[model samples]
Target: MKKFTYENITHAKELNIYLEQGNRVLGALGYTDHSGKHTAKVAMTAGKLLKKLGYDDHTVELARIAGYMHDLGNSINRASHAQTGALMAFQFLRSWGAPLEDIAIIISAIGQHDESNGTAVDPVSAALILADKSDVRRSRVRNTVPETFDKHDRVNYAALSSTLHVDVQKRIITLEVELDEGICFLMDYFEIFLQRLLMYKRAAEVLGLRFKMKANGSKIS
Candidate 1:
């Protein structure tokens, strides 16, 4: 079996069509951007997170692949998109001649990346969770009208900047978001993203690291 690299999957033009369609589906559903930009961040962050923790190289690549492909199930439906995307990824990766062992890791990571019904089940899974959940930014907001922004949109739009920092020596991972309180309060962020925060804590635990969140340069949780 040919070894599948992150470059192989990420640069494949055909795979992008699936990602674009999934992103379009999210856009139509009034959700924040799930497009290439978001996936690219997820992919980079996942790989970086694992590498910083000193995971093996192939595992890091698998984490990247899972992150890049994680949201594709949104193309079908938002509900249970994690599981759907995993199945779809399995078929595509298999067709690409990826080994079953590697395919298993990628699919499992994709399946468990969503916070709705997924938890960190492995190193790659933990990396994917931390990477996917911590991605909050104003750029992700797609609503044309500020007056019509929903809770999710408001929270995202309020975010001025976001950075995920991993401190290997301390075994801690922190997600720092700078927000514009004028658009949404810190309370609003917690109200909408509490679940994601809780998931982040658990995911970091799986990686033997502590998870912390800072909003507006202050630790809130």
Candidate 2:
């Protein structure tokens, strides 16, 4: 059998439709952008994180695939999307004749990415959690009108810039964010992201690293 790669998944027309439809569904619900751009970023970040931690090339690639397909469940609905996406990815990868071992890892990561009922089950899953939660920026906000901004929208819009730094030697994964205070206070960020921050902490723990966050140049977690 041919070796399946992340490129295969990224270019697959069937998978792309699910990703596109998921973003559209989220947009209709006033959520931040969950489009291809976000998935691509998550994929890159997940791969980088695993690579920095000294994982093998195959494992790193699997992480990238998991990150890219993690949110496809949103195509059906936001609630339980993690579990839904995992099932969808399982069937999709199986159809492509991907190895059962690889499919297991990818599906596990996808199944546990949600904060509601998710934990860091493995390196790939932990990396996916960190990558997904750390994606916050003004560009993610689709609604231009301030009046229509909910807590999620305001917090995301206030994030002028965001970067995730992984230091293998120090064993630290830090999320540095430049938030625009004029749009929303730092407290608002916590109000909306406290669960995600807690999830990040656990995810970092699973990777044997420390999770830290700095918003507006001050460490918040």
Error of 1 at 144 (Å): 1.6
Task: Go through the candidates in order and give the C-alpha RMSD of each one to the true structure.
Answer: 1.3, 1.2
For each candidate, the alpha-carbon lDDT, in order, equals 0.89, 0.92
Q: Clashing residue pairs in candidate 2, if any?
A: none
> After best superposition, candidate 1 residue 129: deviation in angstroms?
1.0
Q: Candidate 1, 18: how far from true, in Å? A: 1.2
lDDT of 1 by residue, 1-221 (tens): 24478887887777889889999998898999998999989999999999989999888988999999999898899999999999999998988998899899889989988877999899988999888888888889899799999999999999898889988999988899999999999999889888888889989999999988888989876
* lDDT tens readout by residue for model 2, 99-140: 899999999999999999999999999999999988998999
**What would the TM-score be for candidate 1 when compared with the true structure?**
0.96
TM-score of each: 0.96, 0.97
Leading candidate by lDDT:
2
Q: Which ten residues in a row have the lowest lDDT in candidate 2?
A: 1-10
Best by TM-score: 2
Q: Over the full model, what C-alpha lDDT does candidate 2 score relative to the true structure?
A: 0.92
